[model samples]
Target: MSGHSKWKNIMHKKEKSDAQRAKIFTKIGREIAVAVKEGGPDPASNSKLADLIAKAKSNNVPNENIERVIKKAAGGQEKSDYEGIIYEGYGPSGVAVIVETLTDNRNRTAGDLRHYFDKFGGNLGQNGCVSWMFQEKGVIVIEKAADVDEDKLMEDALEAGAVDVNSDDEVFEIFTEPNDLHNVRVALEAKKYNIISAEDERIPSNYVHLDNEDDIKHMNLLLEALEDDDDVQHVWHNWENEGEEN
Candidate 1:
């Protein structure tokens, strides 16, 4: 919910950079396959499948491709034995970091993740080493307009059971507990409001502010290295931006 604009801005910048859209598609396809295998392909009866479909569409995944994936899952042609793993650690500048990954090869993924952390001046740690610094939350994004009534939006979201809300210059963001995400989203949809994006995220409880240029470079390298991992779905960290909400 906090710094909603910053989060949306970061995502917009990311979605436009498609050096390997295939990788993104593969990731989404994998998730879709997993969801279908676990709960069946009927989105109406499977909330996870429905969410994956929406995400795939937002990412411009083709309808034919989505259908093929659904068929593959329905026919049991795809293997989705992957397990979700979360690795926590501390990055440069004592920044708390959490990485969420889905992998079929746990050994390979774990080894690679540990190696990257060690090489990047970041150390992988025990379960609660850094996880205590983050809280899992549901985030819903809405694109901003030049003129919008913030109070009205806040009132609506609060009534819909959003736990907290934040607004940046270009977006209104709503946060909810993980279990409440779907309900709030359903409430919003009933009102004819379309969310630009919605996802489960780990927001850091606090932040570590960088001081020197060298520190910035070091941290960026660590983040980039972690992001390059194929198994990685999302990376969360506790780095502060002094620039504040825009």
Candidate 2:
């Protein structure tokens, strides 16, 4: 119910809508910049940067842009290198929310996020707000590995401490609790499985389905604004797309 799956599900639909497409690239790029600056610009040596790069590639961001960002960080020209922050809150219907942001100015980022939540039928909470309702995890999505055997992949993932696995039409997704992500990723790599993207995400323990269509329309407005922020990298909520069987 939480973590990567929820985000992925939303993004999958949004990608085709052309909504937030530009903002998506901006946020992902900022993530790439921060990861490189903090970890020394060597993806091989910096797992964080490597993961961000993988995500950028999936979204079709140009390699030149990524390379330029890495070089800028390496050269120290960028001011106030960004860092990721998790803001906990709640949405309508008591739905838990977690917003992950990468910002160069914590004060500005905090204020922007808080203002949005307050304006959109939700209120930002203290640090522990709603976070207790989630579990941190790593989600890996492999696009259409048709030749690969599911059981074998699951077995390898389990040996690496993977918690669960699921597949839909053209994607194979693997989940590993936060602590096991690195180990599980390494295991998968050793097997030469093609991985499309991987990242740290929050997953909710329970979901609050908006029974009213109007609630979804409004909830989406809030989610959209949160995502449009340049500093916001990911938004997780206990929302189920109507009629989506999870």
Candidate 3:
């Protein structure tokens, strides 16, 4: 199971600032609260909550903070009016973009996204406009350490029912069917693999490359603006931006 590695691109684009980390925590906290409200606090019985806990840990969230959020949510102390919404659009040079958000105000989120797209030389489109270019899959990333054996890890991942394994210098990326994510992750954990992150992601089938410097700048600005929004949860796109020095 071999394919192009997207983890490198993801790692390069993620900002490591404290504010960015806090924003990540806030976003994950909202997701956890919603999961707890819908499926209960116990991750043992709540697979969604369990998955989210894994995600939070991978993001370096403190255990105490995760526990506090769960407890608050389970006790009904966390009241959120957030609703999940997806916005599809294009970045400069027709790069397909999809944004997932949890917002209390749809109008505000939509207007903000539209303005960002317009300002960055793109346009927000209707639902499904760019979604068709992507496929949903379970993506699990394991940090590559000195002790990690690439061949062994690949074998184990395949045995765990992963569909593909992609590797770079820093990490191993395992792809699995969406429904099998938790099971595959548990299997890997049982084998003593140190997971970096495990989550469902929309992967683009094809990538768009921009040769124009203006288009590249606009694309980067659009992505940054969307990611900075408090309401935005995840942003998926098909820009082949590896080695661009973000």
Top candidate, metric TM-score: 3
CA-only RMSD, every prediction: 3.1, 3.2, 2.0
TM-score of each candidate structure, all chains considered together: 0.89, 0.85, 0.93
Instruction: Name the runs in model 3 displaced over 4 angstroms.
Output: 1-5, 17-19, 242-246
**Candidate 2 or 1, higher TM-score:** 1
What are the per-residue Cα lDDT tens digits for candidate 1 across 1-246? 347534843664365446668877888888888889889999889887877787788777899989899999889888658788999988766888898988999999889988887887778888889988888888877767544567877888889889888887667788988877777777876766657777777887777877767667766777777767789887888777522222
The C-alpha local distance difference test score for the whole of candidate 3 amounts to 0.87
- lDDT score, candidate 1, position 31: 83
Tens-digit per-residue lDDT, 1-246, candidate 2: 443456466455456425656666677777777777778899899877777777787777788988988898788877766677889887766778889887779999889988887776788888887888877789887655667988888898788888898877667778988766766776787789888767777777887877766567667777778867778778877776622321
Candidate 2 Cα outliers beyond 4 Å, as residue runs: 1-10, 13-22, 186-192, 242-246
Worst lDDT run of 10 residues, candidate 2, spans 237-246
Quantify all predictions' global Cα lDDT against the true fold: 0.78, 0.75, 0.87
The residue pairs found clashing in candidate 1 are none
Can you rank all candidates by lDDT, best first?
3, 1, 2
Residue 65 lDDT in model 1? 88
Q: What is the lDDT of residue 42 in candidate 2?
A: 93
Instruction: By TM-score, rank the candidates, best first.
Output: 3, 1, 2
Name the candidate, 2 or 3, with the larger lDDT value.
3
